[model samples]
Target chain A: MNIILVGLNHKTAPVEIREKFSFPEASIGTFLTQLVTSPLISEGLILSTCNRVEIYAITENAPECFDYLSRFIYENQKYHDNISFDQLTRHLYFYSSTDAVSHIFRVSSSLDSMVVGETQISGQIKEAFDYAMINKATGVILNKLFKKAISVAKRIRSQTKISENSVSVSYAAVGLAKKIFGDLTGKTVLLVGAGEMAELAARNLVNNGVKNVLVTNRNYQRAVELAREFNGISVKFDEIGVELAEADIVICSTGAPYYVINSDMVENAVGRRKNRPIFLVDISVPRNIDPKINTLGNVFLYDIDDLQAVVEANLKERQKEAEKAELIIAEEVETMDRWLKSLNVVPTIIAIREKVEAIRKSEVDKTISKWQRELSEEEVGAIENLSQNIINKILHFPLSALKAEAHLSGGSEVIETTRKLFDLAEEKQPSQDPEAPPAGTAESPEEPISRSRDSRENQ
Target chain B: MEILLYKLPLLFYFAGTVVYLLFFSIKKDSLSNIALGVTGIGFLFHTFILILRTVESGHLPLSNLSGALSFFSWGMILTYLVLEYWYRIHILGSFILPLAFLSLLSAAAFPNEIRSLQPDLNSSWFGIHTTLTVLGAVAFTIAFVAGMMYLIQEKLLKSKRFNRLYYKLPSLDLLDHLNQWSISVGFPLLTLGILAGALWAGDVWGAYWVWDPQRIFTSVTWLFYLGMIHGRLTVGWRGRKAAYLAIIGFMGVVFTFFIVNLLVEGPHRFI
Candidate 1:
């Protein structure tokens, strides 16, 4: 069975939808059992960290299994039946077959995680996979995929400084603010929409020693919930302008159709706030705050795109590690491919034996008729023995070639072509379709996964 | 046994310094460990050499120009190891290693007199006086190195040069703490050392105080460090200004050790 991972992540799913679909720590075992029990699924593992929920399955139809997982998680599944493809499809990413394998390698390696080059997610992915293994829910395919991902993660860590710095947008916004104000202890934070992205920004601001956080949301209860968690006060949604006036840092992540913080409201806030330099971050999709807010004096407004430059520089630093990580992945994949290809041994030996026996029988019959009148019975017996020796000698070269090819993978081009020319193609006697379950992961050849586990576990 | 106890250390010192200098040019942090290791091995040999010399001479290795100077230099090298181990201040090594080499060179230049204790030096206070002053001088040299690094670091920080020194020097706050911390300890120890010297003078020379050039210069170094320490804590002096003052204080101590001993014709004369 081939390894496959298919699902949406922070990059593919909207904040609201992703939040609704996220799995808690308590439900992983049940989810794993459900995923593995599917008709097409051979073995499966689920990696459901905050940023992603990827279902890695060894299966014939990954799309069906992946879709089933999504449907199970999406609480309001009925609404999706009427929704346009663009509405749902834009936010759902899919990778098929080997591409699915590569994507999972990248994800479990944290190369695709929202915070590029983060090391935390790899360990968490391994923990998820190991838990599945202990339950016997994960078999060979998942074992290789998960273990390969861990090796890639390690190669990246040793080779690069990807995790050396905080290059996330939330952090960049705070860093830019620090450069502007030189200090953030007395700053005011005004958050829009109690969205998860908004909460992360709030937490970053609070970490920089923010004194007060003024929160607003269309849902007052959500605002109250966010404010209580962050030790802040909730204001009426209509009072955003007045609240904006009192704040030094404003982050608008409502993902509203129209601008929530309009130019006029910002202009008034600028005047009311007395021209103090304010930092605003718009993390909303579809653009919550107007782009024109950046034109205001003493106001530094950054959209999500603005954060890409910071992440780009950090990505360069992490690229060094990514190369090493990818090399490790390519090596592991080739080894696994070799094992999968080697399972053709049974068919190869059967075909070789049948061809040699037919050649011996034909030569024996032809010689027996010619010598019937002139030779003694003992002479005919000697001819039969000589014919058997010739056949036995002929089979040696092909049998050795087949044996060598079986230990490795696909037969030699010269040997296989010769076998076919000599009428030796019917292998394994066509016995019941030679149905072999996908090649099993007999403990990884070079031992990267076991090495890492031993290092951590023994310690 | 004699080679291990004596000449081998001098060879290790020369070899260790070369390795560190090469590492400084090549920008290798690992080589810093090699330098430290080689020098650490030299330090072990030097300790045995000093003890053997002291035992053979029936002295504490504090007598004569060569022995006193060698002991003082060894003290500098020992301080370097402590700082490197405790603070992991790799930047300090570039400055510290040279001072040690220079002190050892000066010690080599001096004649080893092996003079038996005279009545003036035989008093109960002589060992206390010389030991305390040498201890104070060691602290002074360490402070001076920190101050010098601080000056270079301040320029780099101000110019926004994020080089090796910028990254490796302890934080500005930490450097400031160390410079003042060394001075705070050094000045009072120097003061006590000088006070004991004067007390010994009263017992042997019939005066508790004298205006001898060596004594005056040594006392002057103590006061300079004292002033710097006081200025830093109370007046909030820092960065380059504090660094320069530390440099000045160390110059006085070095002057007392080298110039005053060579040129002056008082009780603390080298020639």
Candidate 2:
């Protein structure tokens, strides 16, 4: 059997095309059932997200399965859009065997994501796999493949910093605040003006457990509206200095061309606050906070460009880590390939023959050694010939029948029966049962995935 | 010879320090754990050497400059291990492991001969004085490390120059907390160690008060940290000011440990 993936992602297809082909979660079970109905496909899974729609399958004939799935999805999309089959097929990308396995692993690891380090794709992949599992659309091969994909994704996450850095400018501001304050709890965030970027950052801070949010704007009504939205009090513009002293974080984005928060003002605030550290982010285009305020002890100031620079640097760091993640995925794909290769009839047949040959040799030697009188050379040779002939005669019909059955699609069931009949499981395969679900990925799947997704969304 | 046993830990410390510095630059989590494991092994070997020396000499191994420096490093690593276990602050090891290694290296440069203890040094009060004082120095070393991290992180934030260290270093709040904790713990140990040393002087030299350079410098270091504690508690002198004071207090420790011990002759001199 071979693994195959057929899909179109945000990179390969436009959103309109992707959306037309994308399967809704509620109807994916019917699609998966339709997917497994093909004679070539033994197992199937459909991963449908806003960014991409992919169909993964285990099949005996990869080329036939690929063609069948393309037509299947094309037919499914015909009901939704008037797009021609050629137009849809032009955007589709297909991977077969090892490439297919590697593709899914990379997809699950988020290396193939729109945002390369995004964590959403992994959960969506798991949800897709779980849906296929509950619908019984997946069998042993796809089960092992998806579980390994999940485990590989987990491994990559633990081993690399791909998902550790924030990519968005507003989230980067939150990340910087964390590096300064360690924890945002009980820290007060003061917004100098009710700008979009400043409001987004304040929302992030509040989500991260920043207890108090104070908004002060040149327009007092706007300040009160923004403060009410944050469940915080609005400070008068004249009290900005006093509020700055109380706030551990200050986000400034007023439209004033000159420095609204000057060095002297920050110095006085620092003195009043008794040298407690404060983080200031100025997301204004023309700059609001004094650059020299950064020179004062315990004060950190970053303007809009500075925040963008931070986001870019973090993206660059993630790109570097993505290379390491690729190496890890390569290693896991090789392991999975070995496991897949072992499922073939050739290896199991050789293993069974080896087991029987060893047993026959040991038993014949034991019987020969039991003689009280030493046998002649001819007699020993005759005994060896008899034992070999007898075993060959016994194994001939079964081995030939196994080989004959290997050409048919029902070969896996026969192979499994032969292994059990011969007890070939004792011969040290990579895994005893690839069908068994991985313990680490099985337990608490929904809680951790949703919780992590929630946290990332908050950021 | 005991020299081989003493030098073995030096090599391990050098390896540990190199690994920690690599971890600092590479920012790999496994490398930090490996660095900790390497340093832990070095600490164990150093402990064995000290225990062997103590058994061989029938006293604590702080009677000579060589033994005292080695003991100082052991205490520092022990304290660092405790802090790391509690906080998992791997970046601190990058700063601290080099200091610990250099102390052992300098200890190896001195004579390895375990001489018979001087009459004045042959007392339990001498042991208590040395242990407490070395431990206090260890706490100051940690404070010094946290302070350096605080300044580096602050510089990174102020200049808007992002680097791996910027992300790896603990937050200013956490580093400042570490600084506060170390100073708080170090000051009292140092005071008690100084008192014990005075008491030992009274027993040996018939005077509790001496104008020894080591004693005067240690008193000055103690006063600096005491003032820091006072300022932080009373007026909230924290963050950069506390970081600077911690760094300065460690320099005082270095001056007393190296300069006063080498330059001046006093009752406290054991080298």
Candidate 3:
């Protein structure tokens, strides 16, 4: 059983369809336990976000097991229509084995997410895996695969400049404020209007260590609720000019059709503030902070469109920056592929060599035992030395041939043919010594046998 | 004798110029180093010929028109090589190669022979004056190159088209500082050179100043560069303004170099 990610995401399904299949936080433990208990399923994780719900699982008949997975989810969630087989049919993505492993990795790393390079997916993917691990629902393949994917995501982020330099102008405004003052600590922030977007930005500001948060909205209760949640003060929407004089950073996101803060008012406020740098974040529809306010001294006023475009432009450039990261990934992928291909040669070579060495070892031990009664210790040791030299001299050529073909095309077939011809599989250990020399060390270079011995042993 | 003494070196300078341009196009560091070494050796031989002319004539070689031009251009090459080594700026070669070859061509092609050596022009103070003035012109020529490169680099950086050759340029901050320093240093040297020339003129011709075409153009150069240094120091005039001033200063130099001397009948018309 290997990686098989099944289910729907934003690309294929609507919210209604996804909701039916989504994993609620409360049910994930039970969900993953049931998934693992299925004889076909070895390990599984449920990545549930609002946009999509995908199941990363280890199962052999990845395509065949869809009915069981969908039925279980439909019965448990009790959401409308409950994502049936026909609905799940088109939206589901099944990655068998390696493709499945790489898919989960890309998803967890956020490489496959709707928003490329978003930091949220990695955390959510981790939560799902942690839930699975808690229930004893993981195996070697899933564990290594998920862990490697997580690290790959981390590598893509830190090594590439894609995540650097904030894209959002809301972030940029906050960024400039930090650049000027070194830290946002002890700085009072006044967010104008309790619009949903403004509230979100305000929360982000508080998260980033703003000392004070003040909210102002036309609706008093909205401001009060936002302020109370963020441990902040609420102000009347009309008193924004007074609030502006106090705020070191102002975020204005109002849905008003007309301008809120006029240039003349800002100009007067600048005079009262004694020319201190007043950061104005205007996330308004038509515009809240007056465009003329920019002409006022020391007032940096950026509107909603400006911040979004800045973030959008930043994301576009990040896509460009991702070009370099793509190069690094391609290099790593090629390297991993080569190493994976090389692993195929390892088992065959080891098995064939073990056979020849066993035969030589057996001949040495048998000859030693045959003379054990008549010979002195020196006589016995000398015959043992002769047998080893003869075996090594006999096996050298075929050993080199097997190793030479190890990396070539049709190399494995030649190795297999050599194995079958020599009947090396039959030369499995006889009366095994508890400890034997490691493979490379075990081969005797001084003996210089033809690789024919290995070929013959394989046959 | 003229071809051996002048044309031979110009050929070497021209060939060295081509090699250096090739060296940069390919980005072969060793080839560039070799180009510098070849040009340096050519300058050495050029220097030897100047010394030989001095020893034969019992006067500093710049007593005549062609001699002065050769000494002035030589100063440009020698200073460039010295600063290149000091700064390790291989890209500057891409700028200086054209100037070096052209100046050498001017020196080689000038018809200034030992035209009945004006005994009055051969004074010790005149030698000192001419040397300082010529050296000052050479220093400004180097500054002019730096200014042009600064403008190009600033444009490329601002456009955000930072390509391979863009990285090869000195940083904008570095080019700005160097551009200012070169103008600052060159301005004062031009001033002293003009002052020395006046002193020597008075000693020889019983007049401290004569508004000859050459002298007029030289004064114009001094004024333009002085304006630049003042603009940069006081007005914080930078970037395009500084670049324009430097170009103006070099134009005066060119007028003094080829045009004024050839077109107008002046004391320096021996060319």
| Candidate with the greatest lDDT versus the true structure | 2
Candidate 1 structure quality by residue, lDDT tens digits, A1-459: 345554557766656655555666686787677766767677877777777766666644333545554454553233455444334434555443445566766776777876667778888987888778966788765676667768767766765455754578667666556544546887889999888877887898789888899889999999998889988899999999888889888888885899988889888887665555567888888898888877665566777877666555545545655666677666656665555435344455566677667777887888888778998989988988998888788778766776666445333343445556775543322122222211222122221211111212221
lDDT of 1 by residue, B22-137 (tens): 76566455688888888898888888877877788666767667777788878988888888889877767777777777767667767765667775567767777877888888
Ranking 1 against 3 by lDDT, winner: 1
Deviating ranges (above 4 Å) for candidate 3? A1-81, A84-324, A341-349, A360-383, A393-459, B1-210, B225-271
What DockQ class does candidate 1 belong to? incorrect
**Stronger candidate by TM-score (1 vs 2):** 2
Candidate 1 residue A328 C-alpha distance from true site, Å? 11
Docking class of 2: medium
Q: Which of 2 and 3 is the better model by TM-score?
A: 2
- Best-fitting candidate, scored by TM-score: 2
Could you tell me which 10 consecutive residues in candidate 2 chain A have the lowest summed lDDT?
A442-451
Question: CA lDDT, every prediction?
Answer: 0.68, 0.83, 0.67
lDDT of 3 by residue, A339-382 (tens): 33355456666776677778878887887788788989998778
> Please, what are the lDDT tens digits per residue for candidate 2 over residues A256-356?
99888888888888888888888899988798887887878888888888889999889888998999999999999878866665566677778878999
Q: Candidate 2's residue-wise lDDT over B74-115, tens digit each?
A: 988888898899888888889889999999899988886889
Q: Which sections of candidate 1 miss by over 4 Å?
A: A1-31, A38-42, A48-120, A123-136, A139-165, A168-459, B1-7, B14-28, B112-120
lDDT of 3 by residue, B1-271 (tens): 7557666667677877888788657644467777787788778888888787788777777755678777876787888888887888887877777687787677767665655467786556766777777777777777777778767764543333434455456744455556677777777777777787787777778899887778877877777777777766665556545666677788888888678777898677665
The predicted structure with the larger DockQ, 1 or 3, is: 3
Relative to the unseen true structure, what is the C-alpha lDDT of residue B226 in candidate 3, on a scale of 0 to 100? 76
